[model samples]
Target chain A: MKIKTLNLALAASMAWGTAASAQTEIEWWHAFTGRLGELLAAQVEKFNESQSDYRVVASHKGNYSEALNAGIAAFRAGEQPHLLQVFEVGTATMMSATGAVKPVYEVMEESGLEFDPEAYIPAVTGYYTNSDGQMLSFPYNSSTQVLYVNRDKLEEAGIDPDVDLSIWENWDEVLTQLKDAGVTCPYTTSWQSWVHLESFSAYHDVPFATNANGFEGLDTELVFNGDIQVKHIDQLGEWAQEGKFIYNGRRNEAGANFRAGDCALFTESSAGYAGVKAEADFDFDIRHLPYWDAVDAAPQNTIIGGASVWIMEGHTDEEYTAVAAFLNFLSSPEVQAQWHQDTGYLPITNAAGKLTEEQGFYDENPGTEIAGLQMTRNEPTDNSKGLRLGGFDQIRTIIDEELEGVWSGQKSAQVALDSAVERGNQLLRRFEQANR
Target chain B: MEKRVIFKGWMLPALLLMPQIVITAIFFFYPAGQAIWQSMFVPDPFGLKTQFVGLGNFEYLLNDPYYRASFLTTAIFSTLVTVVSMGVALYLAILADRLIKGSGTYRTLLIWPYAVAPAVAGVLWMFMFNTRVGVVSWYLGLLGYDWNHVLNEAEAMGLVVAASSWGRISYNFLFFLAGLQAIPRSVIEAAAIDGAKFWTRFRTIVWPLLSPVTFFLMVVNVVYAFFETFGVIHTITSGGPQQATTILVYKVYSDGFVGQDLGSSAAQSVILLFVVGVLTVIQFKFIERRVHY
Candidate 1:
C-alpha cells in the first residue's frame, strides 16, 4: 500500500511539472551580488512559485556597468533579456537608446495593469521618468548617501559619539579631534564623486550641470565646478592635508577600511549598511549625511545612487505579457517591502514604504529608515531631482581624477574642478552628438 | 640550407593555408576593420542611429590633453616593464644555468609565475604592497615611511610597473634558460681554460651567442608590455592617482568598454594598432640586424 501511494504521488508531481514547463519564461539580468543578489533570486523564486503561467528567471550579469554593457551587446545581437538592471549612471545612455528599451509606462498600459506613477516615491521615480511624466524604467534598489559612524572609534577620541555632527562645520571639528587622538583614519569616503559633487549639489540645491541638470535638453553642459562645489572640495583638500580625511580610491574601496573599523567616519551609500552590518565588529551607526549650513537651501536633500530595471525592446507579445507580470510582481507592496527591509534599499512604492512602516520595521530596526526619510524629506527642486547627463559614468571618472589631484595636493581645488568641468563637458558634448 | 618542405600541388598548399587565412580574417582583420569603420562615426548606444563624423574622434583625442598624456605614460610604463622583466629574467636564467643541484626545482619555480593570469598576478603584487592592508606597506609604515600608492603618483606608477613585470619575468625566464642551455658547454669550458672569468665569458662570447634570443624576447616583451599589461594597470591602479598610470590600452578599455563611448574607444584602438605596428617594424628594421644570429 505504501509503494502504491508513492507511485501515485510521483505521477501527480510529474503531471504538475509538465504543466509548469508550459509556463512562459521571462529572463531578467541584474547587477547584484552577495546578500542583495540572494534576495533578488529569492524574490524571483517566490514570484515564479506564486504563479503558474509565467516564470521569471533572474541571472547575475556582473556589476552595474557590466550588466548594462551585456544588455546592450545582447540587444545588438538580438539576445537581450526581457528586463535589465542598469545603474543610475546609465540612465541617459539607456534613455537615448530609443529603439532598445520599452518604457515602463507603455508596458503597463499595454498589459492593462494598474500603475499610477504617483504611487511611486517622486524622488526615486523622477530620475527614470521623462519630462512628459512618462516612466521609462522601474526604480529598483534606490540608495542615498549616508554618514557611517564608528561610535567606538569616536568615543575613544574623547568626543561624544552622538554629539550631533549633522553640520559640516561640526563634523569638521570632530575630524580634527579624532585625528588629534592619533586616529589613523579619522574620516574617509567611498564614491568620491557621488558623495561630494553629485549628492553635494542636490543637498545644496545647486546645479551640477546646465539645462536644469540635463533634464531639459541634450546639449546640457556640466558645471559641477561651481563656487559652492569648489569651496567644499577646497575644504576637503585642506582636511586631506591635515590628515583628517583619507581617500582610498574612486569606488567603494574605502568602504573596506570603514567596515574594518579603520576609519572613524565614512560617507557612503546607505546600501553600504548591508556590508557594514555584516562585516563590522565595532559599534557603528547610520546617520544623515552632513550638510553645509552656509548654503541657502541648507540640507535640501540627497540624490539616489542605485540601479533601475528596464524592459527591453524586441520580444514576443506573450513574452511582453510575462515581463509585465513579473514587473507588477516586483512592485507589489509585499514583495517590495521585503526587498526594502532585506537589502536596505529605499522602498520604491509609497504603499511599500507604508507597509514597511505599518509592520513596525522602521521602529524595530532603528536607523534603517534613514535612507527613505532622507530622500523623502524635501520636495525635490529642479536642481535636486537628480542629474540626467549623458556619458555621466565617464564624467564621474573625470571628476574622480580631478578630485584625486586635490586630495594629493597636486592641484588646488579651483584648478582641479575647473579642469574637471572642462574635460567633463567634452564628454557631455560627445554624448549629445551621439544621442541627437 | 632553408630545409623548406615542398608541396606537390597548388591545391594542397591552398587548402593548408585556408584555415589560417580564415582565422586571421575572422579574429584580427574583421575587428580591426570594424574599429576603423566605427572610429569614423559616433553611434548611439542602441545601434539605432549612427552619425558620420569622419576623423572627428581622432581630432578630439588628439586635442585632449589627457589622451596625449597617456602616450607619455604608456611610453614610460612599457619601457620600465620591458627592462625590469628582461633584466631579472636574464639574471635568474644565468643563476639557473650555473646551478647543478636543485636546478630543476629552481627553474620550475622561476617559470611558475607564467602560469598566473595577468589580473591574478596584479592582485597578488597589489596585496603585498597595498597601503591599507599590504604587509609591505605595513612594514614600510613601521619604518616611518608613508606608503600611499593611491594618492602618490610615483608610487602608483611604481606599483603598476612592478605588478605588470612580475608575471612577465617567468615568460622571459623560460626563453633565456632555453637559450643559455642551447649554448654548448664546450665553448664555455674552452673559454675558462683560457683564464677567462664568468663575466669575461658572458661579455665576450655568451652575450653574443644569446643575442638572437634576447632580440626576439625584447620584441615580444615590448608588445606584451604595451597591450597586455593593461590588466595589471586596471587591477592595481585603475589608471588613476590622477592619470599617472593611464596606459594607452587601459584608456581604450575605460572609454570604450566601461564608458561605452564607441567612437572614441575605436579611435584609440586604431591608434594603438598603428603604434604596435610601428614598434614591431622599428624593431625588425633597426634592432634585428644587430642580432649575431
Candidate 2:
C-alpha cells in the first residue's frame, strides 16, 4: 500500500512537470537594439503579462540585414521564429516566400482576431498591403525621409533659425540660402540612393521604374536616368565640387556628422530623430523634404523607411493563434501611441494617431506631424506609392556607385546615370526572367 | 582465421570514424555539392524556384564585366595585402627577436589585434579612416593630402589595403616570431663570427630560415585578404568610388544576400572556390617543395 502511494506521488509530479513545460512558447526575432529594443521588450512583457496561455520570447538577432539573413537561414533550417521583422526594402523578397510566410490578414482571419485593414493609416498600410488591399505584413516602426535642421548651427551661421525652410521648395533655393549663410556643409544626405533617387523620383512624380515600380509585375526596367534625375544629380555634383555637399560613405555615416554639429542641414530618415535626439547637444527640428518646385506636382509624399513585422509560416494552429494575439496587442492604440512617441516612428494605425492627437502630443512636439502630413498630403499616385521592385537593394547599390562617380568627377552625371540605368536594367531583366 | 580476425579488428576504428564522416557528409560535402548543383541553375528571389541551366552561370560570370573586375580586384587586393603584411610582420618579428627584455610584452602587444573579432576590427578601422572624424583623416588633412576616399579611387583602395594589412599583420607576426625564436643560436653565432652586419645577417641566414614561415603566411594571408576583408570593405566603402573596391567575396555577399540572386551568388562562390583551389594546389605542388623545413 505504501509502495503504491509513492508511485502515485511520483506520477503526479511527472504529470505536473509535463503540464508546466507545455505552455506554448512563441519566438519573435527582431532587429532593434538600444532604446527601441527596450520598448520592444516592454511590449512583449505586457503581452505575456496579459495572457497565461502563451509566452512570447523576443530575441535581438542583429541589425536589419543580419536579422533578415538569420530569419532566412532559420527558415531553411526549419527553425524559423513565429514573427520576423524585415526592413521595407525586403518586402518583395518576403512576399515571394509564399510557403515560408503566413500573411498577417490571413492569420488574423484564421485566428478570429478583430482585424480591420482600414484601421491602419493608408499611407503606412499601403506599403505592406497587397494590391487587393489585404495586409500581408504588420507595419511596425515605419518612417519617411525628412530634412533635419540644426537650428543652433543655422543661428550661428547668421541664418534665421525660423527662416521658413519649409517654403524653399527647390534644391536651388536651399542651396542659395546655404551658400549665402556660408554653410559649408549645408546639404549632406544619408542613404543617398533612397533620399536622392527613390524619394527624388517620387517627390518629382516620376517613375523610378516601369509597371508601377514593379508593384504590378516583375518585368520592370530602370527609368530613373530621365532628364529631371540628370539635372538634379548634375546640380548635386556641382555642389560636391564646390564643397557645399559632401558625399560621406553609404549607410547613415553622415548621421554622426550632422549630429556632431559639423553639418548644418541633413537629409535623413524621420527615425533618425531618436539618435539625433539622444546625441545632438544642440536644438534640432524636422522638416518636409525639399522638392523641385519647378515640377508640376511638387512635394508629394515620401516613401517609408524603417521596417515591418512579417509572420512566418509552418507553425501549428495554436502558434498562429498566439501570433494573432501578440500582433493584436502590438497594434493596440495605447501600445502603438507610446511606441511612436518613444521611437519617432510613424504611428501605423489610425486609432493610434487619433489617440496621440487626443493627448496633444503633436501640439507639444512640433514637426512630429510633418512626416505624416507629407506622406498623406495627396492620394498616392502609382508613382508615389512605394517601390516593390525585386533586387532593389542591389540596384540601389549600383545607383549609389554611379552617384559616387558623379560626386567624385569620375563620370558626368548624365554619363553615370545612363550607365547606371543600363546596368540596373540588366539586373531587372535577370530578375524578371528568374521570377517568370 | 588469424587474418580474418585482423580484418575484423579494423571495423572498430572504422566505427570510431563514423560520427566525423557523417558530420562532414552532412555539413561540408552536402553544402559543397549543393553549391555546385545550384551554380548550374537560376533561382527566383521570391519563390526560390531553381531551374538547371548547366554551365550557364559560369559562362555568364566569365562574360560579365563586373565579375571580371571583381576577380582582378580580388587578386590585386589579396596580393598587395599579403605582401605588405608579410613584410611588416617579418620586420616586427625580427625587431622583437632582438629584444632581450620586454620581448614578451612586445609579442603580446603585437598579437592583440589577432584576438579581436573581424567585425570589431572593421569598425575600429572605420573609426580611424572615417572621413569626418577619423584620426587618420584628421592627420592627413594636416599633411595636406586629399584624404577623401569618396572622390579618390586610389586613396580608397590604399585605405582598404592598409586597414586589411594592419588587422592581418598580428597573425603573421605571431607565426614569424615563433619561427624566429626557433632559429638556432649556433647559426647566428657563426654568422656573428664572420662579422655580418644586421641587414647582411637578415638577408643571408635569417631570411632563408624564415622562408618556410613566410611561405605559409603568404598562403594564409592571401586567403584572409580575399575573404576576411569583405566586412571591412562593406563597412568602409561599400565597394564605392566607382566599384574600385568590389572584391570577389564582397560581390558574392552583395549578390547573394543583397541582390537576392542566390544562383548567381552561388555561381560566384563556385568560381571563388575554383580560384582558391587552384592557388592552394599550386602552392602545395610548387611552393611547398621550396620550404626548407
User: Which candidate tops DockQ?
Assistant: 1
How well is each residue in A348-382 modelled by candidate 2, as lDDT tens digits? Answer: 88888889999999999877888888888888887
RMSD (Cα, Å) for all candidates, in order, is: 5.2, 5.2
> At residue B60, what lDDT does model 2 achieve?
74
- Residue by residue across B1-293, what tens digits does model 1's lDDT show? 67989888799999989999999999999999999999999988778898999999999999998999999999999999999999999999999998999999998898898899999988998899887899999999999999999999999999988888988899999999999999999999999999999999999989899999999999999999888987788889889888999999999999987788999999999999999999999999999888998
Error at A143, model 1, angstroms: 0.4
Residue range A56-147, candidate 1, lDDT tens digits = 87989998988999999999988899999999999999888888999999988898777777889999998888988789999988999999
The DockQ scores of all candidates, in the order shown, are 0.70, 0.57
CA deviation > 4 Å runs, candidate 1: A1-20, B1-9
Q: Model 2 in CAPRI terms: which quality?
A: medium
lDDT of each: 0.90, 0.84
* Candidate 2 residue spans exceeding 4 A from truth: A1-25, A167-182, B1-28, B44-48, B187-192, B284-293
